[model samples]
Target: MTLEGKHALVTGGGTGIGLAIARDLAAKGAQVTITGRRQEVLDTVAAESAGLFGLAMDVRDEADVIDKVAAAVAERGPVQVCIANAGIAEGRAVHKMDLAFWRNMMATNLDGAFLTIRESLKSMRETDWGRVIAVASVAGLRGLPGAACYTASKHGMVGLIRALSEDYLGRPITFNALCPAYVDTEIVDRNTASISQRAGVSADEAREIMVSANRHRRLIRPEEVAAAAAWLVSPGSESVNGQAIEIAGGMM
Candidate 1:
């Protein structure tokens, strides 16, 4: 069915895959609320799209998530779709990794998803239909050689989604995670620079290193991930709960 008049909330929607998903949902006739830490970026993007609104909220803060999500529900009606997409991607060798680095990774990638999902569920439970899509990573399915912390965080996110799906097995709501590999987003740009400096390789070489991670030898597009998300929240997806759909070009 179309998303006409439904309310969809996407975290980290200022840019990247989250923004792409927000745009797609809005185009499908959903009233979308996109959240990020930057009001300006969120506002600018929302301003350009009809039926898309912006809010500034950090998922890492439980109180903030609770309040902001409540406010969104109060204004937009019950949230029929919730996407937890805010995350940080950084790699560090086990030996050189500090406790601060590990904690930060877990807080943003795992804890943030948890808080966002938990808060959203309150409103979702009051409704008859709902969808929760967590933006996980392919690293969760296996491992990334130097990204132990990030991999663990993503694994946690996938686990959380899977468990939630089971918890609501007989309900009208569904919980699923999208695992994508090396998408061509701003995160990749930042990762390219980080990899170049860490590996002492040229920028182009570092970029290729990531592209090679995907079996297709290319960067996956943000729209591809957005499309998967759109389908998950659309009609004919009622039985697709708890699955982590991999967009990794056969990397699975």
Candidate 2:
């Protein structure tokens, strides 16, 4: 499906799944704005594409999110396609998790998605069409050991999107979430190291543990998730609102 002239915004678009989505959208003729906390990373990604615009903004900060989105709207027009993909994934047992760890996960995963969607909606509501997609985790749909805070944050994100989809039932805009398991990203690499250190196992063993987490017994590539995001923005997905499209190798 062609996205000609559509203005799309992706949070944490400097790398991983978000960057893959930005590239796919740009390839489909959309004017894409990629936001991240690091200017260097944004610059690197922007240099790779013609229509991809990069803006340095921290999604966890309300003021930063609002200001950057406003700037993007001013320059590229209203964000008709919004992707809230900024988040942190950390696993700590419930009893061992302190307030700081819990709050950090909530702030980045849940609150960040909320603020990004809210700010983009201001400009989106003025338009005739729009789409809001949140990048949640499989943990959102089920209990994940040693990830109580992270799982709760993702669950909250899906809940928020489902509610908003219902609130705008008849509107042209759609709200949905993409839940993927064991994605092949930097987060997975970090988690592997963490698990190896915690369990006193080889890094390869830790990685295998994550791969086994998926029902298909493999790690998902970032492009796979991007494809799902692209399909959600296509015309055929109009009737697919309020859904969490799980890309966990049939784990859902």
Candidate 3:
């Protein structure tokens, strides 16, 4: 589907699934604005996509999010497509999790999404159409061991999307969440190391453990999730509102 002239914004768009989605949107003729904490990573991705603009902003910072999104809209027009994909994935058992760890996850995954969507909606409401997509995880759908904080954060994001969908029922906008399991990204690499150290297992074993987390017994490609994001923005998906489309290889 063509998104010609549409302006799309993706948070954490520097790498992994966010970068993949940003590239897909850019290829489909949308002027994409990608935001991340690091300018270097954003620059690298922006270099590869002609219409993609990179902005250095941290989603976890409320003021920064407000300023950057406003700037993006001023430069590229309204954000018809907003993807709340900035997040932190960390696993810590509930009892052992400190307040700082829990707060960080909640701030990045939940608060960041709220700020991003809220700010974008201001400009989007003035337009005729809009799409808000949140990149949740399988953890959002169910509890995973040693990931209480992470799961809670994702679950909160899905909750926010669902509530917004209902609040704007008749509006020309859609809110949805994409839930994927064990995607092959930097988060997985970090988790592998953590698991290996925590469980006293070899790194290979830790990797296998994550691969087995998915029902398909394999790690998902970032492109797979990106394809799902693309579909959500396609014309055929106009009726697919308030849904959490899981990409966990039949795990759902």
Candidate 4:
């Protein structure tokens, strides 16, 4: 279907799943504003894509989120498709975790999503149709060993989407969360190294541990997740609200 005049805003759109979704929306004729902490990264990606525009904004900061999203709306019109995808993942055993680590995880993964969607909704509310998607994780549905904080943050994001979906029921807007298992992103690369150092294993072994965690025993591609996001905003997705759609290989 064509999103000819729709405006989309994707946080962390500089790379990985966010970039894939941003590109997908742009390909479908939406004017996409891709935001990230690094302006250069966003600029480089925007320069390479026709309908993608770069806007540097930190999701963890409420004022920044409000200002940047307003600027984007001013330039591209209302954000008809809002992708709250900016986040960070790290694994720290509960015993070893500190207040700072927990706070940072919540700030980036949970609070960031809340701020991004809240700001996007301001503009989206004026439009007749809109899609709000949160890039949550399988951990949101089930606990992930060794990453309690990350799991909790994802759970919070999923909860936010579900509540918003209910709040906007009967409206032409839908809210959903994409719960994927171990997508092949830079976060996984960093986690692999961290796991290797902490688990006394080789990098390949650490990576294998993650790959094996998936029911299908493989790492998910970012594009696969992007496809799910694309479908959620398509013409026939109006009834798929208040749901946590898992992109995992199989039921986990």
> Highest lDDT among the candidates is held by which one?
4
Candidate 4 lDDT over residue span 20-107, tens digit each: 9999999999999999999999999999778999999988898999899999989989999999999999999999999999999999
Cα lDDT for residue 139, candidate 3: 88
The all-Cα superposition gives candidate 3 an RMSD in Å to the true structure of 0.7
Clashes of each: 0, 0, 0, 0
Each prediction's Cα RMSD? 0.8, 0.8, 0.7, 0.6
Q: What residue pairs are clashing in model 1?
A: none
lDDT of 1 by residue, 1-252 (tens): 579979999999989999999999999989999999999999999998788999999888888999999999999998889999999999999999999999989989999999988888888899899999999999888888899999999999999999999999999999999999999999999999999999999999999999998999999999999999988987899999999899999845
Model 1 / residue 33 / CA error / Å: 0.8
Cα error of candidate 1 at position 91, Å = 0.4
Model 3 TM-score relative to the real fold: 0.98
Better of 2 and 4 by lDDT: 4
**How does model 2 fare in lDDT?**
0.93
Candidate 3 — what's its lDDT? 0.93
Range of the 10 consecutive residues with the lowest summed lDDT in candidate 1: 243-252
Off by over 4 Å in 2: none
The C-alpha stretches of model 4 lying farther than 4 A from their native spots are: none
| TM-score of every prediction relative to native | 0.98, 0.98, 0.98, 0.99
What is each predicted model's overall lDDT from 0 to 1? Answer: 0.93, 0.93, 0.93, 0.94
